[model samples]
Target: MRNNTGPYFIGNNTCMFSCWAPEKQKVTLRIVSPKERDIPMEKDDMGYFHVNVADIPPGAEYYFMLEGEKELLPDPASNFQPHGVHGASAVVNHHTFPWEDAAWKSIPLEDIVLYELHIGTFTEEGTFDAVIPRLDDLISTGINAIEIMPVAQFSGERNWGYDGVFLYAPHVTYGGPEGLKRLVNACHQKGIAVYLDVVYNHVGPEGNVLHRYAPYFTSRYKIPWGDAMNMDDRWADGVRDYISNNPLYWFEYYHIDGLRVDAIHTLYDSSAVSIWELINQKVKSLRETLGRPLYLIAESDLNSPRVTQQPIIGGMGFDAQWLDDFHHALYTLADSRGKRRYEDYGSMHQLAKAYTDGFVLSGEFVKFRKRRFGRSSAGVGGNHFVAFTQNHDQVGNRVKGERLSLLVDFERLKLVAGALFTAPYIPLLFMGEEYAEEAPFLFFCDHQNPELINATREGRKKEFADFRDEGEPADPFDRNTFLQCKLNWLARRQGRHAIMLRWYSELISLRKEHPALRSYNKDNIQAEVIEPGMLVIHRKSKDKNKVMVFLNFAEHDTTYRVPAGNVLWKKLIDSRDARWNTENIASAFLPSEITETNFVTVPAICIAIYTGAQ
Candidate 1:
């Protein structure tokens, strides 16, 4: 386990470098900068070659040369790659940062209002420091936690971060380790939790050199991004160690409150002890040692409760999983251009099912899967699921990468936001979603390999083969594709955008302040379809406080009977309220909360929230 974890140990201007190269007979440490030298590394019984070199200060660039190989390779566990992925790795001491978040107490997963943002497009400067001045804005929007996209070093400055080759190193372009540490410290100081997205299932094709040093990949299984990591293959102990240690590294060194583990279904670990089990145990132990909560949220495609279920019940003990089903059902039902996943969606019934039950396709026929998929998520607690109207994938994997705001009208946008906030689960807001930012989040990268670039273009073409009616997708290799995705923060103060932001802020306040709206207690929720394209959601707190959410997905106004017949209901929030949407000041919308209400008319694609204890 010694060499399976951190290989670089620096103290007193001396660094001990270790490389796992069992395939080579000799390994040499080659210092390229701050004076050049080549020192032979001694091999241990466990296939690890290590050497303790004096006068090798932190920030010095070095590389490893294998025996009989002419090319020098960067360390697989490099902490910083300042000169891109192919350049020599720089030594970084993590203790140099002055962290001021010792008294920072992170909230539980249920209370986390996660706002996911890519660091590059979040600000004009696109550095860690640039995101600091905007923290006050996020706080005002009621975002308590920010789940940053992967920041590990990738091939170039522009990437989704899933293509990162150096898992241990923070991207040099984003201010490197020091910049990330400062961001985390600042977030904790403002009582905000920082969650980092990490990719462990596969590595990027460009700038990837882990296979050169050790058995970091396996030929047994193929994943779309890159080779499947060698989780259960021969010599997989080191690979498991690598995957498990990454979370601890982020939590301990970077002061990250949680990790949004990306695409866990792609991991092929058939061993008795899977990588999930290994990482769960380690994080739990670390949680005890740190005396604070550490969230291990997974982004799994499988609707299996095993992701968040406890170990005793044959589950992975993760904190929660993203509920893509909720997004799929709601998107297809409301948006004009839905039905991408093909879970047999596009119905008000399915949206109601996603509200009452966690997954809409529980053992139901899926047109894409061509079989009955998923088990019932009936008794699962809402806190174990994270709900959203749109995420990075749902928006970016489109022909034009158009956001929901652009595809739907203003009322429908408010309806979608209402659906997400009222649900009994953790809510996540994609960056720019609060103000309905129409800028698309396109899939982009800056790989230097020509062959890889061609492959990427071809792959994107194949992905949207069925959706060619929308015109050809943006050229991902084009620099304009990356630049077009940057968020226009100034737009938040403008016309419709300002109104949407106010509506979202009101919904978030209602979700946090109202006891009936507390998340994760699914037993208090009851959703049913009242009419065609009309559904009513009834929620009650233990204190008898009640909230009724009326949604009309039809194109025209529709009438629906109230949850409690002939009873008085108080109007709490209306998407058409003069306070939020100024256009509805003198609108002719039906009064949903009458003193003796039986049924009331709701505008098309509108949402009205009523509260009262009958």
Candidate 2:
């Protein structure tokens, strides 16, 4: 299996172009840059056509011509699509980048506080270089890792990036390969790790020319996306290499520390070696050679069979996974406006169960699904799961793309952030969630086809009908839809927004600095419902340090007795600390410790943290 199948510079100003078209009788390499030169490609026995040509330097644009085809096709694995996805592929020399991150070593997965952001809406410039100046603010917020939404080339500029067609190319509008490399290098130098989100289940429908070149998709398995990939179908072996090489390309060329593989549930492979497993094995070998941490986090729920286990254990060997159950349970309680699938989550007890047990619905019957779902993840390490209250899917996929900050009160927002940080899993924050930005992260795209645009709008409205009281869901084709998602960075420095940012920063700091909060051992943590809309999470460190976090989701004050008849418990922080938020000023003067006899009245809709040596 080849690790590459694109234009590669073999010598100075000399390049070799490779294409996989076993069925084609005559495969021609048509270089359209510097000078129009058409070189008839010689096919090897293995179905790959290769030819080395001189004078084809970097930035040279090219396409492949198949026998009897009226139009030429871009390389299946083009590294740089200078124009849009339909444009000719530009040659990019991987060796040209002068990287200076030699001393860069990413932090452990267990210790990461991931901040997920979309490139188009992350800054006004909407380019990779624009994110460089914001690195300081991210680090100061206690984020060690930033997970970028997919930047793969799609139709036009604005997209959530799930519809990416060219797997290897970075979005041209986002400044392409060099821009991404510069961003990665800058992040590594600043002690920040960059993780890229990769979509491999299926390629985007528009500008997708893989069908013209080879058997890239199959109809054997049912998948939500138009066509399932040909992982276990004809030419499956070649397809595996093509899909597997994507992660390696990012790591080797762009210096990405991790990959968040999007939607593995759709990667259906009935072969002896599943495509997901094959990818894990390849990445593991690459990690060994590089002698660095390279995490593969699946965008699948814990229900997917053996997703986080090692290959030796008859598993897919993903390092971690995104657990949506935590988000559902917490979001349902905080925002009663949730619909459809959220009907399964309402009780605070479920959120508590999600905290203690890795999956609340573990092997249990799900009312929403009308069947048993999710094997028990009770034994899984908390580090094996990434938990958050909201992510891109939760926010951007909404009919209106309303952020959690907009749905809940200011105090409840603080409460949820505390819950996320203190929970026994790696925490993630969506862009501008730290400051509670008023702007929504709406679903958007800039597809060139008017027919596809009309279809997309209709499909979105139908999608919302399943779970929401539908008005016309935001008009995705509107340029305003894309522009509205841009983050208000200035808002972060003003009034309540600044306070919320500080609140998030402080919570993240405590999660990092405090021993009890840092430990991801679910066994050392106890999450229980104190009463309706009230919860308490007690954590103990291996070093005998103890912390108890009280979360009150109710709008009214609730009195509770400390379970442990404490001699002395040091109050570390309160979400409603009047000094920071300027609310509940009278209650801020409470003592350092309180016994079980003294009924502690937790402020309405507040989060309070306490610590003591156990």
Candidate 3:
């Protein structure tokens, strides 16, 4: 089957247009460019309407007229929407751009330290080109992979990119296709990989004309936004092909290194050969052909190890998955009153279990869902799970969109960062977190439809009704709400922010330098709750190098006995030191040695790292 389903140039001046509309009896290619003409398309055996027209130049706009309708519709697989989603689709020659990353190969998944950022709020300009100048700063901070929020064309200029309509086109407001290519090429040139977030659960409600083209949606299952994609129903081949080929298109044309698929749990596919497996097969083939490592990370809520298991074992082959259990455990432990869905995770035991087992609710009863959730990930490697202290949903879904910097003190924030970086799994840091930016990442959008605008406003208010005491949520439709989310890049070198940035950079450097810190083998790591609000983790590498991390989450200074049998332990990092800040000086002048007969003093809400050989 021909995988190129969009408009492509056959020669210099001729363009070939193809679309899958099995239900439409007659389809017409309406050219609205240099000359206006309607040409009838011939149907192939595979329910595709295609035609090769002569004298059609690049950058010409066109649309598909279905069933003799006077009103035309944009192509379902538009490569570049020069206007918005409702506007005409423009023909773009894919081979026109000059790429410079000829020898660029993505780093391995285990070695990746992902930094997630939304393009609209990441910079003042909020364009792809704006991100290029900041690449050196991120590289200096030890970030090797940048997981960008979705750029797929949505209804308006500003959105989280979750409610995207056109999956193939980049948002024009963010400089469109060429802008994205430039960013990816620049990242590769600096030894950084780019991973784009993609939404495949359901299309956006506004300007989504997929249902009009073919049976792209099914009534059997409905998502929170709309009907689920028709991945396993009758006449679903074209829909499946379209959805699966999107990542390949990005990797081939845009040169993206990986994809972070949004909400894979909502993709209800009951086929014998699941859509995920098919996508994995295709990606595997592409990896061999391209001779580069490409990754597929799933944002899955289901704690099934099969999500990252190999395809030969009756599993959906994915490289890694977002592990929310660690975040919930850490959040609930840090702030007892800040419970949204963390009903079952307030104890230090849960945090310890999350560190060692990778999941807190592995076949355990979950009070929030009133059922036993998650299966055991006993044999799963830790690199297959990506853990984070904060991400887009954790901050944006809150009533006030408050970041960790606002919820906890600098000491506790450093403690959490210490735990995250030392844990077995791969670590991901949200943008502005390393330097502790105070800007809130609120949920904002610019929907043209009044109904959608009202629905979004009311939906956010009702979603956090229980947290009314935190104050009323900001109006998502307001322009100020979007502007408030932009990061203050100039604040990184200021007081306290500069200290936090140095601490984070040092932590990342330590994690990368020590093989024991980056080892993902759960069996080689051990975690134990030493006291009421203190936990100690021991990570061991194959070379017999051991690093121990002590975390204190209490309100006062405490002393814990060190388990250094015969080896002398040296202090690596202390969050409460005077160099980091002067506010917490309980352990500022404490001794760095850890003796078997003596106890070490740990300040309130602080973390200390020690290295020794076992």
RMSD of each: 1.8, 1.7, 1.5
lDDT by residue for model 3 (1-614), tens:
23747887766888889989988889999889978999999998778998999988887889999995788999988988888999999887778789999999889999999999999999999999999999999999999999999999998889999989989999999999999999999999999999999998988888999988899999999888778899999789898888998888888889999999999999999998899999998888888888898899999989899899888898889999999999998988787665655778788988888888887889878888899999888578999999999999999998878899999888788988998999899899999999998999999888899988888888888988888888999998888999999999999998889889999999999998888898999999888896779888888898988888888888877788776578777788888778888353455434686866578777778888888864
Which model scores highest in lDDT? 3
Give the residue spans of candidate 1 off by over 4 A.
1-3, 340-343, 563-568, 582-584, 590-597
* Model 1: pairs clashing at backbone N, Cα or C within 3 Å: none
lDDT of 2: 0.86
Full ranking by lDDT:
3, 1, 2
Please provide TM-scores, in order, for all candidate models, with all chains considered together. 0.96, 0.97, 0.98
What is the clash count for each candidate, in the order shown? Answer: 0, 0, 0
| lDDT by residue for model 1 (1-614), tens | 13355555567888888787776789999999899999999988777788888887889999999888899899888889999899999988877789998898798787889999999988988899999999999999899999999999999789888888899999999999999999999999998999999999887788888888788888899887657899988888878877898899889889899999998999988888778888989988888988888998899988898888877677888889999989988988887657655547889888888888899888877788899889888789888898999889888988898999899888889999999999888999999999999999999999888998898998999999988888898988798999999999999999989999988998999988888888467778888886778888988888878888888888778887654455568888877666566464745465745654476888877788888755
**lDDT measured at residue 209 in model 1 versus the true structure, 0 to 100:** 80
Model 2 misplacement above 4 A: 1-4, 339-341, 466-470, 565-567, 582-590, 596-598
Best by TM-score: 3
**Candidate 1 vs candidate 3, TM-score winner:** 3
Q: Which tens-of-lDDT digit does each residue in 312-422 have in candidate 2?
A: 777888998998989988888777776455777788888888888777787777888898888878788889999998899999887778898888888788888988988
Better of 2 and 3 by lDDT: 3
Local distance difference test, each candidate: 0.86, 0.86, 0.88
The count of backbone overlaps in candidate 2 is: 0
